[model samples]
Target: MPPDALELLSEKGSAERALTAALASFQEQVQAVPSLDLAAVVEAAKPAFSSGIAFSAQLVDVRGRHKLRVIVMHAGGAEVTSEEWADEVDDLLQAAGWMLAMLLGIPLAKQARPVEAEIAEAECLAVVGVPDASAGPEPSKKEDAAPVVDLDVALEPLTPQEIEATHQRILALPQASRQALTKAFREHFQVPRNARSIGDRITQHQHAAFIDHFLEECEEQSLDGAAAPAEP
Candidate 1:
């Protein structure tokens, strides 16, 4: 395909053709179930099957630059061979992923498709021209320009000691109490701002969850230990 045609297909302009063409290849295998809406079926299958999409998805590059993203959501097995028609398969999967996002009402911008990308090194740098101390019109004697300041900040990784201390604190807490804390943390700290860097947040939350679970287990054990006074 021409690069422009490929680019058009990648964008939303020719999405339907790209989508249908990609999905058509699977017609023989998935089989047209009577009265079954194919798009709806995929939507229903999403929660269970979407994670696999990433494994099958790839950013296809030509030379050092990205050309397209390819993903194959449904396959017979890990050994399904595509040696002969890999390009077709890649195109099909990419289109299908796009279609799935569309059918499920996911915004095009938020479609769960991998991106093939390329960036020029020169374009990546900041361009700052040297200041000319004498070129500008003279500053008014009555007015003062705002002060210019550059703020430099550094981010530090969590120290091992801090991690250990957090872990130990979680371990000391009852599981039930830990669960409560995790829930509170998730509700109070993580969800409000929609934080993207949730790994550390989850680690902290999980400590609370463990404590909650531990407490629940202890409570159950205590109940069990308490004699059922002459159960009727």
Candidate 2:
């Protein structure tokens, strides 16, 4: 968070304290990488973003629950918005964080997956053009040849037809757990905008890779990221 943002939040009344704490806790979560030095990474990370898509998020207390609204602003003057609620403010913030990473075209780190998330990720690869994302034998041309992508080649922006097809696949998930996860995946990965035009080199490669990494992390997450409710 920017110092100005923090300063402004500190001035808000008692009701805003929960949001302040939530933001603090969420910061700890994202910066938990042990190998990275604590102060150095944060000092370098937050600053003015001059170009590309920007993410604007707002979290407010709703009775005892927390309501999160995330808006993805494209450089082209287009935007996408989504709303979700959680009893815990941190949970909603974390999910928003993941969606932000995806939208900003951040690269995902490889992680082990739980059995369920692995299956969900594989099913998603079916739509995103991952080569034979299925665990089965490599698809053949005469058969149901799956689309192949060479990571070396530059990636093209998703066509409306492709976006529609991928979205339909996201809606086909059998369980709400998987559906919620996939929805976040599709919403960001399929957003038709110049991601590379943003911070860092957010090329289409990052976009495609984000799906695989994000899903693996979802499976790897304890309590399954913010997509799942807290276990009682």
Pick by lDDT: which candidate is best?
2
Error of 2 at 96 (Å): 2.4
lDDT of 1 by residue, 1-232 (tens): 8999887655643443333333333321332112113353454435435323212434456665543332333232221111112343334443444333222222221122212111111111111111235536844411232222232211233343343334334323333333344444455444534221122343343333433443444444345434335458
Task: Enumerate residue pairs that collide in model 2.
Answer: 52-198
Per-candidate TM vs. native? Answer: 0.20, 0.30
**Mind giving the per-residue lDDT tens digits that candidate 2 earns over 174-222?**
3333334444544655643322112212335445345445444434443
Count: clashes, candidate 2:
1
Clashes of 1: 20
TM-score (C-alpha, index-matched) for candidate 2: 0.30
After best superposition, candidate 2 residue 68: deviation in angstroms?
A: 0.8
Off by over 4 Å in 2: 1-48, 60-65, 88-92, 111-232
